[model samples]
Target: MAKRIIKAETVQITYREAIRKAICEAMHQDERVFLMGEDVGRYGGCYAVTKGLLKEFGPERIRDTPLSESGFTGAGIGAAIGGMRPIVELMTVNFSLLAMDQILNNAATIRHMSGNQFGVPLVIRMATGAGRQLAAQHSHSLEGWYAHIPGIKVLAPATLEDARGMLWTALDDPDPVLIFENVMLYNMEGELPANAGPVNIEKAAIRREGRDISLITYGGSLWKTLEAAEALAREGIKAEVIDLRTLRPLDDTTIIASVAKTRRAVIVDEGWRSGSLASEIVTRIVEQAFWRLDGPIARVCSEEVPIPYPQHLEQAAIPQAEKVVAAAKNLLSK
Candidate 1:
């Protein structure tokens, strides 16, 4: 019997499935690449994004580590420094905190500390964002926090193409790379071209073009921002939607260009508003493109509170299209 394989030839697929296919393709292409994490093997991963990979690749490569994020993540870093490509999966963004020292102190500083004598070609994937009523400890969008650091790249794949394409490109990078998959986007249905493969991890993509204002966002908040753009369009306001695909090395050119053109910007981020990626972008706009602005910049971010477990509270705490729309309108009025 001919072996059946995953394929996405202009067919509808979920964000989760696209990621699994990317892992499969990468493993097939590079013998040095391997996946390691809690429940990543027999348990098919915490979110099942690595399902069937264990059977296809075997235990040697599909390692299921104990509940020690720091231990496994450190091991993955060592493997990378030893010339092997390792994909370390931290079950949730919250859990990554356990490995902070390993990630920030070692993986992020190895090359610099060693004076370019070493490189950590490692990729760390984790589920992020507040949704599904996971409560404070289990949920939060901290990708923006990691973007604060230097020597590492941060990527947020908001669409099917990115879910399928960004992994390999990140793996190809010489330093550590972190990929944050919004938990809410796993079930999202989308299409990817059959030939879709590695995508650029260096710049932002303008999802929609407009002249009224720029709706800047990334990850789970991107969809809400896009919906707000559509709503604004119907109300005679053309809002450009910019998806900051790669959070770190933040594609400042794309953001400054969009804000300079629209003359207004509303940053919609699932992370907290205080000192967030949104704030960084806004500060950059003010510093670099202040003259192009026609109105004050606004931000629609998660309310300043630990994400609530109740569905209503959770939804209200995070950025929504309605909030984005209101912010845009208020900016336009100002």
Candidate 2:
């Protein structure tokens, strides 16, 4: 079967702008939708993604909460149960650790616990990953941890289209959804159609196609994998790049098929080596596509450590284009 393509008339915009527009559009279209978080109103969001939205939507829709992640996140879950669609921003993934009780216990389990009568139609947005020298606490990628939960949907919007489109679809879902926005990608610019809207949150996307090897990744790592793909091309090695948009579902069909076609695989993730999402992807490929493999699967992941404060150490800790290229090259050699 031929690969699918998405065509749109797009204009250049930064990743931050695309996200801001998506929120603005969602609020304008649905009166039930409201945003609440630290610095969301008067302070214009921690990353300023909600800048100017307070004036347009007013204090009612754009609320600023205290530094209580557990409190506000729980409130958002309660509000969602009460039939209101709330977009709760937790500032950063590290801070979200405070709200894990509400997220993992309440938001994720309410529907099943209530026998399907209750659905937490909540959207939790948080900044994830490292690159800004924010040290171990402020910078970490925990989307993999969230993806471990069976009930909630985990999303990492790596591209402009995804940044602009995924939130609305997530809000419309009956269960809870967590959107992990890589802090490094806020300034990344790309062309997005003026009319771009909600996109399907079900399947993975093939960002770049090849037959020699498959480099699978998502979020901030997507760009690094793509860069590695390009570098590999120069050496006459063609690499297929698969972006796992919705991490929870895993999209085994797309991943298995790609590995089956290429006959080799390399999983890239920003999380640590042990119990990481990359480990899960590798396990899935081995389980489903074992017969198709021409060599052992490889992985490029962050070094097992609390991401360091120093620039050089931090760079070495996370997966990079060079690391991905080396992993893919090793796979092809065998």
Per-model lDDT: 0.94, 0.95
Per-residue CA lDDT of model 2 for 89-153, tens digit only, reads 99999999999999999998988988998999999999999999999998999999999999999
lDDT of 1 by residue, 1-334 (tens): 9999966568678999999999999999999999999999999988999999999999999999999999999999999999899999999999999998999999999999999999999999999998899999989999988999999999999999999999999999999999999999999987778778999999899999999899999999999899999999899999999999999988999999998899999999999999999999999999999999997999999999999999999999999999999999998883
Q: How many residue pairs clash in each candidate?
A: 0, 0
Candidate 2: residue 135 Cα off by (Å): 0.4
Error of 2 at 317 (Å): 0.4
Residue 68 in model 1: shift from native, Å? 0.5
- How does model 2 fare in lDDT? 0.95
Error of 1 at 41 (Å): 0.6
Extract clashing residue pairs from model 2: none
Error of 1 at 322 (Å): 0.3
